[model samples]
Target: MSGTLHLAQALSNRRRRGRKKDFRDAERLVKRLVSQELTLSFVPDGEHRLWRTLTRTRYQRTRDKVRLQNQLEALLEEAHINLSSLVSDLLGASARRRCMR
Candidate 1:
C-alpha cells in the first residue's frame, strides 16, 4: 500500500451525465489509482487543520493588502500624484505630507 497521498480532480466527460455513471467512473478510477499505487489522503488532525486555516487566512489578508496598495497607487497615478517617485512607500510620512497639502 502506498503511503503517499495524491490529490486530483475527477475526470469530467461530456458524454457521461448521470449520478450512476459518475459513481461507476469514480469506482473505476479508484481501482485504477490503487493499481498504480496512489492513495488519497483523509482529513488532517485538529492541529494541522487549525494551522491550515490560519495560514490560509494570513495568505488571503496579505493578498488583500497588496490589492489595496495597488489600487491606491493606481488612483494616485490617475490624479497625477508622484509620491511613489519620492518615497519607497506611498503610505509613509512624505507621501502623507503631500496628500495633506
Candidate 2:
C-alpha cells in the first residue's frame, strides 16, 4: 500500500512537470501570435485609422476578451499557474501599490 502511494505521487509529479512545460510552450506561441498580429495591424496604410479602430474594438468586445481569457486559462492550466492569482499578485505588488497608497 505504501509503495503504491509513493508510485502514484511520483506519477503525479511527472505529469505536473509535463504540464508546466506545455504551458510555457503555449504561452510563447500566444505571445508570438500577438506580436505578429500587432505588427501587421500597425503598418501605415491609408487604412491605418480603420485598422487601428478595428483592433481596438476587437480587443474591447466582450466576446473577444473572453476568447483571449480562455486561451490564457488553457495555457495557465498547463503551467499550473492560476492566472487570476498571478495577476492579483502582480497588481498588488507593482505600480498599483503607489496608486493604492
The digit string of per-residue lDDT tens for model 1 on 20-101 reads 5767867776776768644445668789999999999999999998899889999989999777888887767887887888
Indicate which candidate wins on TM-score: 1
lDDT of 2 at 48: 81
Please provide, for model 2 over 1-101, each residue's C-alpha lDDT reduced to its tens digit, 9 standing for 90 to 100: 35211111222222323445777755654565556431222235558878888988887896776777678667766888554654643334653554365
Which numbered prediction scores highest in lDDT against the true structure? 1
Residue 37 Cα positional deviation in candidate 2, in Å, after optimal superposition:
52
Candidate 1 lDDT score at position 79: 93
State the C-alpha lDDT per candidate.
0.74, 0.53
Model 2 lDDT-worst window of ten: 3-12
User: What lDDT, from 0 to 1, does candidate 1 have?
Assistant: 0.74
Q: TM-score of predicted model 1?
A: 0.57
Give the TM-score (vs. native) of candidate 2. 0.25
